[model samples]
Target chain A: MHESASTQTNPSPRVQRAPQQPKTADAYVVTPAIDVYEGAEELRVFVDLPGVAADGLDLDLDKEVLTLTANRAARGRDRAVTYKRRFALPREVAAENVSAKLEDGVLLLTLPKRAALRPRSIKVTSG
Target chain B: MWSLLHNDTMKLFDAFERQFQDSLAVRRADTAISFLDNGDELVISADVPGMKQSEIEIMIEGEFVTLRAERKPGAFEGFKLSRAERGAQKLVRQIELPCRIDAEAVRAELKDGVLTVHLPKAEGAKPRRIPVKASA
Candidate 1:
């Protein structure tokens, strides 16, 4: 007889907090795919939002909730659509130091960690 | 006889493996596209996010258009990937138009990771209005 076993990891508590969305039935809403990267100093997020211009992008951070909203214009037979997403920050970050840029329909966001949370090298003094 | 049976069984498994891979390729190549007619011209829009203009290839022949694109992994320096829903992929899609197209006048433009192809209708494919004449 052969025995097989598998274990499932529990979902993070922070990830359980679903994004708050209001009723919007006019235009189609899509949640763009995103990739999150973690570094010693900051966290980087890459969002795939094709057909969105810079003027149609909006980013806001209130408390620990970061929201991203992008509007795509109607083209040919394709109707206008809105891409909206929200994420709860896992760690403290410097709100004022966050930076974002869009290139080739990909949005890159950098969130710097708070000074107290950032890892620093300790210098050793010889006695 | 035993060796011959083994060979036949291996060949059957090889054929099944190839069929399974082909179906997976078809599913992965499903790119979103929209085709529309704009008076004397036709337009095609495809969503190809995170792909550069140079990474996409377009070929048009007669009434058929094919798009090939490759998206590389979005890797960051000095950073570790935490979550990745989108990964490197290769897309190939071929479309057949309803009517003939003017190959010489075909134009394509890529903006914001979307490829738009404008194809003009050929002379023979365009609709013509016939003038009514009263018999004297």
Candidate 2:
């Protein structure tokens, strides 16, 4: 039977989690909703990953694919969730300038664009 | 049908869930919750990712409990949203507890996007200890 419309809304979301959780098989995966912004200097991604702490967060960028995993401590609840998601970046990223910040369960990723990809105004010099 | 199966075949239902984990991807939203009774109090815990504590409101009336919150949009002007699963969500929850709780004894905490509420059991609803003495 289907639950009521209100109850049917999916409520669980997480990233990478402890291996021991979901003992019978793979850890439960929750897909958090995200918002990606294309800025002049950087591409920013904001993800809502409640219940995940700083230590439980894992982020990796390989080639052009960015992968994020977060573990939310269930606190003795039934499921200790591990949320995972991957984003294929459209443009090259500046290797050293990429940054990340998390607060109040919201993860903010600042992906700086490569020198060539960033838009720059070229001055016209008349000789 | 819901009540019958949930009350009588809980173990079987749980087994079904366990069996499906390996083969399928389960989507969990922020509305999921757990209700527990430890005899002294009724504890409720839920997941509400990306929401700050300031955005949440809790209301208790008699045997009912309600949770309300709004998630602020993080995007700004001139920013294009490439992908979004939970773009911007609002939560409204109302449920009834089997046992009455003390309104003054309620306590709550929101951390790491998880919200936990503790409602102390009403004095009259608590089970009383029985005193047994040697028969004279």
Candidate 3:
């Protein structure tokens, strides 16, 4: 099906840089795509960063800001590319307890809500 | 009878052609836009991932609106880079409004990688009420 006229009218203002020519020694940075899912008590981030190893990834959380940085090497080759992405955490999170893991070039991060931010179910007694 | 079948086949092919074009359109790297209609105000949201606020520009002329931004190259050079992705890139897009917009009343904000532009409809474009008096 064809997209509506309104959809066609709205275009992305972000520009894409052209790929550079290969050289004897070249360094390139690749940014991974991200997917975010929100739960009742936590927010999960899934980043697609191919060719990156588990040890090369880093996750930093400062207050409500979350930064994801990784150094990825192309598969089966000496040349490598680096990827970096930052996310603004919707709510305050426990920076100390946040954890990350890399599996098959995808990095998954789980940000847990701070103890005080978690909603509490109050008990009510009938009079 | 044969002619009727041929017409149906042509229609099917046309539909397929349109679908292919749509898929190609969405294949573009940057792809998210949102519009909000509040009773008297309108908000348009554009996604500009990896772009700094300083690099973005918005212009309005008559009933047309345009957005532009530039993306700079990353620091990594040499060492035989394999794959490089993500970074700022140049982009420009424009839209024509169906009705006149009040340019002076426009407001825009960039936050969390999203750009939102608020435009208020012109006084004449907004609905109005006229009082009626009893006949003499």
What TM-score does each prediction get for chain A alone? Answer: 0.77, 0.73, 0.66
* Native-to-model Cα distance after best TM-score fit, residue B106 in candidate 3, in Å: 0.9
Window of ten residues with lowest summed lDDT in model 3 chain A: A15-24
How far does residue A39 in candidate 3 sit from its true spot (Å)?
Answer: 35
lDDT of 1 by residue, A14-37 (tens): 343345433234556777777777
Q: Which of the predicted structures, 1 or 2, would earn the higher lDDT when compared with the native? A: 1
Per-residue lDDT for B16-52 in model 1, tens only? 4344332122212125688898869888888887788
List DockQ, one per candidate, in order.
0.22, 0.23, 0.02
Per-residue alpha-carbon lDDT of model 2 for A31-81, expressed as tens digits?
A: 666666765566687777777889989888877556788887545545667
DockQ of 2: 0.23
**Number of the top-ranking candidate, with TM-score as the measure:** 1
TM-score, chain B, predicted structure 3: 0.64
Q: Give the per-residue lDDT digits (tens) of candidate 2, residues B45-105.
A: 8778777778999999988999998886665775555445566768788979888788998
* Model 3 lDDT per residue over A1-127, tens place: 2346755675842222222323213545444555544444555565655445567676767665555666644322234555555555443456667788765445667777677765568799999
